[model samples]
Target: MFGGVTIGEFARLTHLSVRTLRRYHESGLLAPATVDPDSGYRYYTADQIPTAQVIHQLRELDVPLADVAKILATEDAEERAGLAGEHLRRLEAELARTRAAVLSLRRLLRPHDDTLRVELRKIAARTVAGIEDVVAQDDVLSWYDEAMAELDAAIESRPLGPPGGRYANELFTDGRGTVLVYRPVADPPVRGRVHPVHLPPSELAVVVHPGPHDDIGVTYGRLGAWVVDHALAVDGPVHETYLVGPRDTPDPAAWRTEIGWPVFRLAVTDVMPGKNPGQTGNPPP
Candidate 1:
């Protein structure tokens, strides 16, 4: 038999609104202890107060109603704790993503009075320990992290140069293509998805992108514009030189990356000669 206390009393005890309690009752999440046969009034007991309070807390954390029901219905305390823990992990992941978005937004909305300096460099062909795979655009960051970790483990000696990557043009235009990450090392060996790659000499229009990679797209956009305005584009994979990165510094402000776009040279830049045209360090503001 169901015990008796008015639904309003249960709502007050739980600090939940009467309307919320009614919705929960209709959804079969928190059924009242009793219902009057004639008046159709709902009833609850003092024992139901804790269950209502638990449900309220779970809802406040934005747990799905079905998951909330499981947490409530489970009789074993350990089982309930496990259910709560799973949602806790999910909540933490969401909070991290939200914080990253806020940081990126702040950088994007702020005014940039500085010009992105672009350099013309001709890199010589070299052999290095590398990994290459076809990957989707969304998976680049995760893939790079895994590949770099593997590279670090496989190579024991000091690196000849900083780590770098080549992102095929199709990867950006078509959303998926080849990605290669490497560390320049002398006499690199072939081992478990890591092998020696002979990179061909090529010319690049390079720009240094500063800070965390969250707003890196902005720098990319600026650099691409410079390339289009100043030189003939070469159909080659885009290169990124990790100068000062997460592996080198914990502070995001100190991170510096060189974004290099492969290009064919024009005899003269597509610039209007109103002043000194030799100034290539900083492009048009």
Candidate 2:
């Protein structure tokens, strides 16, 4: 400890715990400028304060320990800044997700009166271009993005109707299940992974989920309760129609999704099944 300050002063100056400095020592993220062989004391040079502060800031941002080490080891100032910047972007994304979750929780607890609006309609049988896959619940978003992109590329013509997806209950219950995404095209052309999917005539209890899909679960829960209260029995996979979404618009506030449950005794006026199921519409029952 001859050339550098004692660990006690270093801790006070850096505002870090003595134990933390020792841990950082063991982890090799920060090393003492000198160590006394006889007394086993650690010492850090005054110049090391800025590096310690940087490590503290990075740790506060939740950067991984390995990344912190890599950043500290970087010699070029620009390269170090770039590494830290990348982690900042990731932290920003995490903060956005956290904010979304908080807003969803607030809406769930408030229970909006208009959130329960339900529309019962008859959907006729039809064939559409689709891509099907068995995806884990966590992977659904990414898989949907890729599938929808493929569907869009294959079906260059304007969609006859909004794109839709059929999700099996097992996707939520057991965490993995079949998910089918389809675009209503006048004539479904099969190419690569795209296939013509035949949908059956179904009576749906539908509800509109407004805004970003982050809180769509809230709308889904309310719709399920409505179905139960109305004595409607869910008979098939849940249907989700993207009336307005990322593919059509960049603004999430303008996105509108239809959550439909194919149900029995849905109180919908009957309609004939045909190739174009969308033509079948009944007054909201």
Which lDDT value does model 2 have at 198?
97
Clashing pairs in 2: none
For each candidate in the order shown, give its overall lDDT on alpha carbons: 0.86, 0.86
Q: List the residue pairs that clash in candidate 1.
A: none
- Judge candidate 2 at residue 236 and give its lDDT: 82
Clashes of each: 0, 0
Compose the digit string of candidate 1's lDDT tens values, residues 1-285: 446878787777888889999999987899887898988889998888888888888899999999998888899999889999999988987886787678767766888645678887889999999999999998898899999999999998899989999999899899999999999998787889999999999888899989887678778877787777664566599999999999998999999999998887664444544646557652331
Give candidate 1's TM-score.
Answer: 0.77
Write one digit per residue (lDDT tens) for candidate 2, span 135-186. 9998998899999999989997788999999999999999999999999998
C-alpha TM-score for every candidate: 0.77, 0.73
- Evaluate residue 215 in candidate 2 and report its C-alpha lDDT on the 0 to 100 scale: 81
| TM-score leader | 1
Please identify model 2 stretches exceeding 4 Å from their true place. Answer: 1-27, 32-54, 64-67, 70-97, 111-115, 266-285
